[model samples]
Target: MHRQFADLRARFLARKYRTERGHEFACYGFSRRLGTMVRAIDVVFEKLPPELDTIPDRDTVVDATLMIQAFVLNAFGCLDNLAWIWVCEKPVLNARGKELGPLEVGLGPKRRDVRASFSKEFVAYLEKRQDWVDKHLKGFRDSLAHRIPLYIPPYIVSPRLSKSTTSSKKPVEMPSESLTWGSTTSCRPSSADWASGGLG
Candidate 1:
């Protein structure tokens, strides 16, 4: 994985330094393509079933891993599609000034200034968009991929369910007669003791 990343970085940097004469970075290189696949694999592995206590044996682990890998692949493909949408979606700028040409041809100091402004706004927009996407996808992924049936603790469980489990169990009761009251019954109530006045 490290080697693949190194190769990808090298390829990307090579393209970065190359003269863009409309042919430098035309095709996706072998390393870059494999890097994408590796990314998908990583996502899948990360979502593997966490609660393996219920798993019967070693064979089940292997089977679950394969299933998780498939779900991860599907998730990766969805994310890739989203990335493609972002890349392909151009900002619709309605400008009254002189129209600029393509990026390679028209990019200069002034163009760069415009790009910087656009980049700041575009980055914020993309981040917000991705956040919205994540909000929607997290629940779906939790159910379809990362979800594991967790046991409810007895203490944290509802009273009815707990009562049903232990039918013979009895709840502790307090005696009202044990509570202390005033020796004299005919005394004026204090103003401070107006709210929830307990027996003296």
Candidate 2:
């Protein structure tokens, strides 16, 4: 696992950083690498997808947050779950028949079992984080969905119209056959037109 992480880190640095000094690290040290990952995750959360933005089913959100959190925290082997119960100090305890109180001890014979039970506080924390992530993701998605494409209008030139009404010098003479019977234009269509039926 350590070797795999090392290989992945090396590959990430090589691809993203691309520098002459290989030992200086692209972004930061290993811990800083985790920080960088968290920051990236933060951006991912901030730009929530439109589909996942709305308030989702509680169970579904819980499941998704657990999966995402586990991956981000590198909590493989189910150790993260255990850590959530024991390390983060979040667990429910039942001491009905026992002398100790709820916080005194956990369920099962061993302390491990006692630590893994669900706790209200921890569940609340997870819910809050999920809410935050959901809001940002939704906003990001909305922005993307409503974004418009850019376009540049083509240049156009229109013929200028003449405003003068007075004749300049003598009007040019027109051929006798060029003028129609009741029209001043030469190209006049008569009743023998091809568009009689109209073009649909």
Candidate 3:
């Protein structure tokens, strides 16, 4: 991954490319990173139990949840960086009629400038998904990045008792435990959405 990123940076910085080529480079980078995130999410889900209730082990549940969250955060980070690149790839006219590139624009303007720099179709798509993004993805990312305390409920454990051969023997019943992460909800974007919007 590091080597891939190094190659991308080298390509992006190559002097032979014109302005349009720069945008293509940014789009290529976004597609590659998005593919990485999708593969990661797939792997994480594959390790998870078929059903949440089937996870009898507490440690396994905790580890799985953490791993999922980590991947989610990474995916969001990739989107945010792509947005920055999309907005900053070209020069924009300033209030004083001066042309400003990414260095002059900085990160502060990227968020607001994205809507203008990005395509109308993409902007509309973002508007449609604004609520989901804000409530689920952005909120979760902010919480993790800021080191905010997450309310992880105690893991619910259900124990299965072995069958006894003796007529007098009885199996012990174990109480089931459940874990909740407060009222927080998560949003998982589909590959189509990523391809359409992130790639666009």
Best by lDDT: 3
lDDT of 2 by residue, 1-200 (tens): 45555676566455533332222333244434444445544543544333442333455434434434333333121222223224223323345533233233422213333434547676556455543433333222222223321111111122121112133454544433332212111222332331111000
Instruction: Give each model a TM-score.
Output: 0.23, 0.18, 0.52
lDDT of each: 0.37, 0.34, 0.50
Tens-digit per-residue lDDT, 16-127, candidate 1:
3222321222224333444555664665445443432232344544544455444433443444332332222332222543332333111112233233434666656645
Q: What value does the lDDT take at residue 70 in candidate 2?
A: 35
Off by over 4 Å in 3: 1-32, 52-59, 96-110, 147-154, 157-200
Rank order by TM-score, top first? 3, 1, 2
* Model 2 segments more than 4 A misplaced: 1-33, 37-117, 137-200
> Model 1, stretches more than 4 Å misplaced?
1-55, 88-122, 125-200
Residue 13 CA displacement from its true place in model 1, Å: 37
